[model samples]
Target: MGDGALSGWERSSTARVIAPARPRKLAKVPFVELADGRLQGVVSSGSDIGRVYVSSVTAGEFAYACSTNNNRPCGGARGSYCNHIAAMVKEAVLQYGAERVARYLKCDLADAEPDAASLTRAMLATRPPAGDSKAAATVFSRFLRHLAYLEFDPATAPLPEMQWFPPTRAVA
Candidate 1:
């Protein structure tokens, strides 16, 4: 009883355990350029990331890549922004200055706040030119609106509208 009880409670001398370090979040950076002269930039928040491209197709018209990929055309026959759009825009603003690029794009640099509400309004206001179906145009418009809403308020943003075309009947 003298030594046995106290000996059982003796602390073992061993190295303390440590937890692993958390991975660092990726940084937003301008990285690539497209054939049409659009500059691409990557923005990352943890694992989620996106790209933006900025370019001018005409003398006074500036365009930006609002989508994540560059596989499709943007407006009708006009080229669109792929994943590289955002980066391009950021680089352009740095190289040409925001004022010059805004003038070239015919946009107000003063209102260029990347807020979701403002972006949603702009997307809804834009309508595709004639020849594109109303449904298609509506879908595209809704897409941008949804993106804006998602950016602003992910917790309460509505689900993206889905379009369903009737299946065509094959000739017998």
Candidate 2:
């Protein structure tokens, strides 16, 4: 496995992937946008295949759901950030461009790479400072409500489906 690769934990347990962990390079995989604004596709891998599902959690933030266990840590018990979801974000950026992705998510696409710390700061910074009642009022309902929901159930919350995407081309 490359230094950048990540092996996902077991879908049912906290055990990390014990097999050869590889980074997924799915550049050619086409995705269809589902009715709920999620991108859906099938990662072909002989008999050990799986489905890939990605959704814009909020502007700039994304959520991933997969049927396979070998993936980076997105919506898993281990962490909020993961390579599997990062792959999906790259796909969305490639398909729709960073501008569109950012517009849809309500943040800068340049900050969409899956760095949880930066993402958190950027998210909090978007708020209307501390005393700007006017700006706060304008964005309070939408942003605060969404933020509340996210706080209630962080991205680490297990999604019933599962998550993962294998590399299309192996990188050296």
Runs with alpha carbons beyond 4 Å of true place in candidate 2: 1-28, 32-47, 50-77, 109-172
Q: Estimate each model's TM-score.
A: 0.26, 0.34
Candidate 1, superposed: residue stretches over 4 Å from native: 1-80, 110-172
The alpha-carbon root-mean-square deviation between model 2 and the true structure, to one decimal in Å, is 20.6
Model 2 scores a C-alpha lDDT of 0.38
Please give the TM-score that candidate 2 achieves against the real structure: 0.34
Candidate 2 local Cα displacement, residue 69, angstroms: 10
Q: How close is candidate 1 to the true structure, as a TM-score?
A: 0.26
What is the C-alpha lDDT profile of model 2 across 66-99, one tens digit per residue? Answer: 4332332223312342344344455654554444
User: Which lDDT values do the candidates have, in the order given?
Assistant: 0.34, 0.38
lDDT of 1 by residue, 65-105 (tens): 33223333333223333333334455545444444444444
Compute the lDDT for candidate 1: 0.34
